[model samples]
Target: MNITALKPFKITWAVLLCTFFSALAHAQENLYIPLETQHNALVLSVSNSHDLNIAYYGKRLNSDKEYSSVLRQYNQTGDYSQVLDAAYTSAGSRNLMEPAISVIHADGNTSLSLKYISHKVEDLDENISQASIKLEDTAYGFNVSLYYKLYKKEDVIEQWSELSHNEKGPVELTKFASGNLYFRDAQYYLTQYHGDWAHEMNPETSLLTHGIKTIDSKLGTRANLFQPSVFMVAMDQPATEDEGTVLFGAMEWSGNFKIDLELDYRDNLRLIAGMNNYASSYKLEKGEIFETPKFLHLLSHNGKGEASRKLHSWAKDYKLLDGNGERLTLLNNWEATYFDFEEKKLFELLKDTKELGVDLFLLDDGWFGNKYPRNNDDAGLGDWQANKRKLPNGVSSLVKEAGENGVKFGIWIEPEMVNPESELYHEHPEWVIKQPKRKEHYFRNQLVLDLSNPKVQDFVFNVVNDLFLENPELAYIKWDCNAVIYNAYSSHLDKQSHLYIDYVKGLYNVLERIRKKYPKVPMMLCSGGGGRVDYAALEYFTEFWPSDNTDPLERIFMQWEYSYFYPAISVANHVTEWGKQPLKFRVDVAMMGKLGFDIVVGELEQKDLQFVQHAVKTYDDIKQIVWQGDLYRLSDPKNTDFASLMYVNEEKDQAVVFNYLVNNRYGQGSKRPVKLGGLDPEKRYRIQEINLYPGTSSYIDSNQVYSGDFLMKIGFNPKVGKGKESVLLKVEAVR
Candidate 1:
């Protein structure tokens, strides 16, 4: 029973069996662990062509493991109660087909069905083939066994120098995320599920399988089930070049979604399962290994047609404005104002922002204070009142001046934290998050506002409500939080009951009240940058600050990762120079999302401003297309040499192409121009050049011959600028 030889087999099983086992493991109504070991060993066997066999060696791990069942009885509601059914719950007749855990004890061999759940996975590799075998080893300790079976025969390509591995470390098994398996063969790398439950399927069931957990977000407390998950691999067959895929859990718990890859190996390579985990006790049997090359062309790319159509559908149905009736392209004065600005400086920034075509102007933190400075997080966090010295005429005056500038005024607030020197902290020390009779160790010299209490929620909401009442012109709020709760405690909650959920609910209630009162002011979510960026937060705030790091190259991958489930319109990509560490990819990558300038641009040269102006104009032209059109990823993050392309088309005849030139450390620089597809075949597109980066332009084709399948093919260079660079091309159909 040596598990060491099983490493390669486990890798194969993880890719192929992840969807299969996850579905069945969570298929039962009780959400109970059937194994006797807290950590169980996972095994996968191909019973007979179509039927997959999955086995969990050690299911029940602890004496208190059965207590999880009691918790389920307490939490049971709606569809979750259906899992207890004796028969398998069918997915019914739909384009998506997913089968749950089919348990059979015949000859002591268990067989289950691999279920394909998400539209994203289906859309990503719709044209590619997939097969996997996943094994979870909980027998000795927690570990996973995976065996990847490549179904796609075409030239299979995978990258070796992936992002996380680039940094020097112990090669953490689950460094990218937790409760997941990370493996790399010559052709592909794999990441399995561990603790992340928000992206799991049938969350209630996933939660019951794994222990129930809580997550804090702008929406308050959400009970999420973090499950160990898996994905499938396939050779891409889209309009663009194909890359290997590692599909996993996203949004819902039961889907076969994948993060697309760009293959760079010159040699025609195919991925085979390998035993890379030697440190763990799991033993690998070389003879037990299996190899198969099958192409997954069915789930490949359908182009921008379906994606754009979906975006348009979401936009037409979703409201862009706040309940208070204010439209937003908000301008916050954090960079322009900071703590050094006076009322006069605020006016200057507001006036300039108004002229720059911004709809809402927000005064970032540092506006409120008394003797203690509001310039930093150390002072006046919960002191929500105006500083008479700094704001002599009060916020009403500032709001009036902003109104006169033709822009609605907004303010920043962090209701969850309180400075020790602040009046609120002095008045009630019990309000901070702390254990009873224990000294409260502070972060940033501040304590977290305990949202578990209704009193705290009301008090926090009242502060913002008072500010809004005093200044009716205030139309937006930039809600900010510096950190997550390090020590979880709530005075109002029971000692035995988990207080995290209560804290989340209280936070949610406060926002609900604020939205009810000042429905007109849209709150832009900002949490120490993007620590709070998730689907839960997006449900409340109209937009989110994508990250604290706004460097374009970094943002391209970040935005790409986020775009898998979130809408592009909800992500705010501001143009901030931070410290002009120049990279060629800056402007183009920043414009891919909701566009705004975060840096102090008042001092740039006329040419630079002209570049900014042109970017803004181009943004306005393609805003709808980027926000509502379907997006197709063309480059691989693993291979920096390959270019990244995001194509948005409003009409079949019109398309906008965003090209990024990534720097490759090895080999000759990318020379091949990418060939594009999914365009109007009959109409000749008069390619209008809108160059954002420096590059020589030449049309590969002159005479517009009968535009048919050929229209699906257009080429662009893989590399353009030195180091990191990107290009923007908008193709228009000319009659």
Candidate 2:
């Protein structure tokens, strides 16, 4: 044979095969998958090792540009043999960062190596599209599916993970985070919310170092000691409201949760967020699946302000229950009558409510109980029945009276707690969450019910169901949980470790049922105030009580911090009689969110009453803007003696600005120029001061019309005088 002639032909064929394989590998590496919204993109790609990595997460990129170089760079870290940029970091692998999922397999294997198997993209709706990536363990039957849903218009992305195994034995899940995110080399600053009972949602920013910083809640139920939300800014300098790259997210779980920010030795950062796996190790039997709560996040190139607006828009458009609905202005009798209220006292309060132009009349606590009257926090928590001593005619009569007075009726109930002296507790002691011999601890003289029990769940559901059934005219329900879970035991569950997860699931089950049955009715979630303020509960409830402390000054700081991740429509702010501040100041602060009065309205002087009436009417006119608008925090109270904020509607036609003199400075009576934001710069607007004292003139020239550019750039000065002084300005496009 002609060996030399055959060799050239063989070499030519081999070269063609090598070129084809090389192109195939290059194409696979360049297979960029993007979960994108209108302005943002969470782009992912598969590495040469078949590991999925977040290639880019920020402003949307040009569609024509190839992203293979970016993906290669992201996965090419020199420090470790394996890249630490896994889309969903799993433990028992080469990755040294905090793992998003950690488990002990049936084979007693603590390590897992997940390889990308498949992927799918589906359009859930006009505004939402979901991208899912499937992965499988290299040596086990375990499987995981990572999901990313892009809320297109809101520019927000929600991520979650689902895990399952086909092994014969049960798998122990030690840690299961909802989502994991990795950022390349950058100086990181974290803005997290933390505070105690009355001072919920206090924001504190700190520079991230070469270790893990954790924000978590051990409180079984409220989960408010530290909110499951954070903002991570990746920039060389400190974070600013309107500048830098900001990554913000919230864990949509009402139970105990944790968020960990791990800044690696190379200045890179990894974020792990989800259920707190403290004592709640979940066991997944064969063929069973576990799904983590949705961890919603968004990336903003324009800074934290844009991140907040995007989140608010997403919550209002999709996540929040009845997000588009207008929250009512109500008058609650908590501060007025408390547990001392009777039918007659409520009727008088209803009269005052009607006179003040309040939309709804909420009868707070003390209306329930039979033999052990709920006259105080010490008793009658489990009894949902009307108190024969306080309201002899039951809640139906109050509903009828409220209706007659031209106001809708609402009632407060703590269905998750039971007083030790109550009939329900006496009859079913096993229903309480307590260990067999461990001494039980009580908060507010009440114990938490074991919602992990189906029977207890039924009872709690019936408490709400029966109220609406008995009083068909019931307009609203304020669900309160006054006590945190103690003893950490569930008699109904075989695994005591499953108590926390099971309890939250049961509560969600009951809430889901109630919501499905009464989809239109408004429900407020109040867990000793701001305790249960999480996205998981907001799915079923309309609004939440931000805090028990309604002092106007304190709320200014609290609500400001809260606005970072939550929308104004979801915050139930009330004008209370806690501080010695003026009634106008209180009403103005309350008007910032959902307007409600908790003060004794009947005791108001004529001038104060007139001002109250004016404020209620004013809030109604601007409530839509406040609820559905973009919130721009013009001035942070934390840094200045004066705090200012503004809300501008989507159409750029209507806006409202609020200026508060938090404290009287040494230069009292000085004029402070406050700039406004979120308005159409080219449009001319007319300004008017509302909810003012009868004889007092406006601090700004209300008659003048100015362009939005002037208002935002040059600005106007509010006549500052005494501390606690505030002014509300209404801006309307001059047609």
What lDDT does the true structure give each of the candidates?
0.47, 0.83
Candidate 1 weakest ten by summed lDDT: 157-166
Over the stretch 653-725, how does candidate 2's per-residue lDDT look in tens digits? 9998887877776754425677888889999998888778877877567678999999899876665568427
Candidate 1 lDDT, 115-143, residue by residue in tens: 21111111124323222223221111212
State the local distance difference test value for candidate 2.
0.83
Worst 10 residues of 2 by lDDT: 72-81
After superposition, the stretches of candidate 1 with alpha carbons farther than 4 Å from their true spots are: 1-248, 251-327, 579-585, 664-670, 691-708
Error of 2 at 467 (Å): 0.6
Q: Give the best candidate by lDDT.
A: 2
